[model samples]
Target chain A: MSHIHIDIRKKTYPARDGSGEHLAIRDLHFELAAGEFVCLVGPSGCGKTTLLNLIAGLDRHFEGSIRADEGAATLRIAYMFQNPRLLPWRTVRENIQLALPKGEGREWVDHLLEVMGLTASQNQYPQRLSLGMSRRVALVRAFAIRPSLLLMDEPLVSVDAPTARRIRQLLVRVWQERPHSVLFVTHDLREAIALADRLIFLSAPPTALLHEVTVDIPRGEREDETAVEAFRRRLIGEHQQIRDLL
Target chain B: MRSLLYHPISSFLLFLAFWQGLAVILASPALPAPQAVFQVLYQEIRSGNLPFHLGVTLARLAVSFVLAMSLGTAIGIFLGRHEKLDRFFDHWLVIFLNVPALVTVILCYVWFGLGEIAAIAAVVVNKLPNVVVILREGARTLDRDLLEMAEAYRFGRLKTLLHVIWPQLFPFLIGAARTGIALIWKIILLVELLGRSNGMGYQLHLFFQMFDVAGILAYTIAFVAVIQSIEALVLKPLDVRAKRWRR
Candidate 1:
């Protein structure tokens, strides 16, 4: 069964200077299956973040409906934005604890902090943390609730290469253990190939899905950067639209 | 501990020496020696007069400070969140902010008939606008990204306010509070001097009538000591705790 179904016929923003409306997304319809890892690859300004916002219920003015298997109201959703977005005044542990539902235990928070190798720094504030460490705290916060559907908007972008790789590995490890449907948005094709079971390509604004590619390699083998790069090159060569859009 | 205490203590001694030297040079009744002021302060304390007046003034300050802060914070947040309400009330805030404390006190007494309610209301009227202005700026500058995070995580209203909104507003609240306490106590004194039968302000007025400079100095010293202690004991600790999360 699909974990969540998103059918946004149109989404638009009014021009600030009294001009006509600017179309953001048109005819973007897709369903995320339970436990499936899907990466949305799109060009910059393609409204990927806006689409995620729609699904996360942050921006509810878009057209059409998003239905989950458990009904929209009951389905738990967690979002990780591009920036760390951790509360600076809150300690790392307190930040994660804030995300948990009432009556939930702190054990899950401790376990996630341990998985992220942030157990020692959990009492420290976000301002004292390096960007990589803060991002790890943000990831721990996202997983603290064990949401049924997780939406990430280029969460690993702009990090140093080694830290980004380490974060991706931690992300995959946690996702494997928790087993949830994830809609990951990224501009990096190689990163998506390494992380996603299926890659959905999107065009520039008034964004619509252009193509879908399935990574045939086994999950364990995807850890090899050379193999992921080779697969990305082959996929780009095969799909002229993917090459043009990217 | 020594480093922290040494400078302030030495500075205070330096101030006393200067005052003593100036008193000896001038040798006027209007400018009494620090020792003479201390003697008067001791006498008032011994007779129970200083404590009673100080307690009464402090009670008025507490009531007015709390009322202004709570009311101003709620109104400020409401106005900040709603552009239309802010626009509507902007002129009123400006008028109240600029009106003199003395005018408000006299008006409250004239209108409400020289009662405790009038004195406190006068102080609240004078201090509320400042708190509102401070907290309005705070509410306006709240982080949008964190608010979105709260919404995505389903924090709900109360949780969002406590964990997310409150921390962001804390610095502003502190700003409002520090200024509020300072402003409220001064206005309370003015209100008491204008109409009330008792309090440090009324006693100061009585001393002024008799040209009892030593008595005025003693009362002023006592009040300043109390205010400084509050800042040292209550506000400084709060500020340190708030900034503990910062690098």
Candidate 2:
């Protein structure tokens, strides 16, 4: 498990053609304790992905100090991109194997295949699998590393509702088994509420943290449809701005 | 096996019939009957001269092809990944690509003297540019998403290249290899003809001086048959193995 501390004084992207600049983030700050599940919710095009990129160390143009406390081993961060970036040339099992730490065995990959409901499709190439199946493989690949921090960038955005729900449940199941610090970005408030222990909401572009909502509902009570509906309703009623963004 | 034999055998017979018809029509030494050329082919094979010359040509082709392809792919990948380097070296690729094979052979012969090194060097220089151009496009178009995935997962450099980068680059490498062999073998003949006293091209040159059209045709047919066998046996099988992942 890893605790991530993010402090951004300001971050501005220069204009490509020498016009004005784009203020992607300004004075935004947040932190995550070890094994905490946090969901970042924001309006569309509000630099949610940019924030994840900064935390994941993919984008360094930002003026920020993002630190992850090193545990026994150096921190291993696995990112599940918005797209299911499985290599088309590799099989599902091989794709997961690509993310295994050095000297890690194939038994973990077999277990991941079982967990992802991909036993039959383990030998299949990415081109032949459905998008949901591909996403599951990507998730399996991410978790196979037994990461200290996992950054998910709208992983279920383009899937249908049923598949998205199933994948979300699969994600929760895997996380519960081996808890890791997770920062999931999503524009869907319902998804954010359903998945995260704590929800941090952000405003439009030049994003600054608006609010942090802790889910009081227990883990066992979370899967009930009526309970989720009640919690979502209460959340929207309490945060009118979140309802407005929705 | 029957299906495979049917088309090629039928095509071979059809070609022979056309050749026989032309021989009968022309009734000239320039155009010998297919059977007459085959007779010379059989005699040369039995005498071992044809096989020896063919083996020499094959050896030269192998060395030059290996040199050209390895150098070309390395340079192409280097240029493709580095945009500034690509810009600096783009004009050089153009120059080498446009230079004629015959001219290159003659220049090598003039500069390095009439030797095996000159002949092989000419063949390599002529073929290298084409491989470079093809692989440059391959390297340029490598998927950024997959690369980011590799980095995020902390894949080591060798693993990333083998499991991620090499698979993406395989099709381009295959393309370069196929065309390199086709173009380089023909150029090797010119190199051998101009400089070397051995190989199929040199033998063909000797037959030309004697005005022996049947001997020339026999050598040509033998060389072509060897190339076709390599394509069918080696290249096609390798292509299928590399691309088996594709649906």
Candidate 3:
């Protein structure tokens, strides 16, 4: 059965200065098959975040319906914002644990900390962590619930390129253990290519669906230098705008 | 003890020396020497009057402080979260905030007729608006992103409030508490001064009428000492603990 289904007809927000309504996303429709990793790529200010928010049910004012194949009440959704959004007052472990349902044991949490290389920093507060470390913690928290649906909004946008690459690898490793339906939002074409099973492109503000690309390459081969180069060249050959972005 | 006393002792000695010099220069009964004031203080303590009045004043401070803080926080959060409620009562908050504390005390005394309830009610009324104002700002500036995160995760109401909301609002709570305690202490003293049978302010009022300068000085010094200790011991430790997360 399809795990997640989103069929948004229209989503418009009032202008900030009390002007008039601005169309954020309209006629947007998509679905995520179980265990599929779908990336939503678009230009900056393309309302990718808004679209993700609508799917996550964070913004209900928007027109259109988003339904989980499993009823909304039974479906568990985990969201990772562009910002780490850790509770500053809580320790790293506490922040992660807060995401878990009550009375759950420490084994999974300890395992996640070890896997994310966050064991030493578990007792430290969010402010004490570097950007890379904070993002890792946020990822752990998002996955802590072992959620059926995971929503990521450019979760690795800010770090230095090298750190971002490593974190992305760590992300793939974590998700591999339990493949869940993911709808990730990003503007980086390379990242969307590297991680997503399928990519959905949206046009700039007053966003509309533009294109969809599927990566048939096996998961393990995606990390190889040559494979990434081939995918990059193919995307460049096909999508001129995505090439300009890179 | 030695380390703690080193700085405070030097400061206290310097203050005493300055007071002694001023008393000598003025050479009036109104300005007693520190030695004379301490002598009166020692006598009052030995006779047990100082402790009794101080105890009464402290009890009032405790009751009023708790009442104002609890009620203020609830109302502040309610007003801040609900726009219509805020619009309805925001003007009332402004009026209450602007009203002179003395007027509140006088009115409380007149309305309730010089009882414990009146004195405590006056102090609570005086401090409540300020607490509400602070917590209201805290509620207003609440991190919407974090709230969305909590909502997405389906956090229970208790978990959301304790783990997400309270931690974010903690600094504001501390701000309100610190200011509330200081303000309530002063207002409680005034309430006692206007109409009360026993308390530091009542004793001070009696001494003022009789021109017993040393007695007044003794009471003032005792109250100041207690307040200073509370600031140093209670509030300072709390501030440090609450802000351990901050670098």
Top lDDT prediction, candidate number: 1
Docking class of 2: medium
Best of the two (1, 3) by TM-score: 1
For A1-246, candidate 3 gives per-residue lDDT tens digits of 247778888888888999999888888888888888999988889898888787777789877788877787767788999999888888999998888887684788888899999999999999989999999999999888888888999999978998998888988988888888888898887788789999888888778877788987788887776887788689879898666644
Per-model TM-score (chain A alone):
0.97, 0.94, 0.94
Candidate 2 residue lDDT tens string, A89-151 = 888888888788665857777887898899999999999999999999999988888888889
| DockQ for each numbered candidate | 0.93, 0.79, 0.79
Per-model C-alpha RMSD:
1.9, 2.2, 2.6
- For candidate 3, the TM-score is 0.94
Query: Could you give candidate 1's per-residue lDDT for residues B50-148 as a string of tens digits?
Result: 999999999998888889999999998988889899999999999999999989998999999999999999999999999899889989988999999
- Cα lDDT for residue A178, model 1? 84
Candidate 3 chain B weakest lDDT stretch, 10 residues:
B1-10
Scored against the native two-chain complex, candidate 3 gets a DockQ of 0.79
Q: Please identify model 3 stretches exceeding 4 Å from their true place.
A: A17-19, A239-246, B1-8
DockQ of 1: 0.93
Screening candidate 1 with a backbone cut-off below 3 angstroms (N, C-alpha, C), the clashing residue pairs are none
| Pairs with steric clashes in candidate 3 | none
Q: Which scores better on DockQ, 1 or 2?
A: 1
Q: Give candidate 2 misplaced runs (Cα > 4 Å).
A: A71-73, B1-6
The order by descending DockQ is: 1, 3, 2
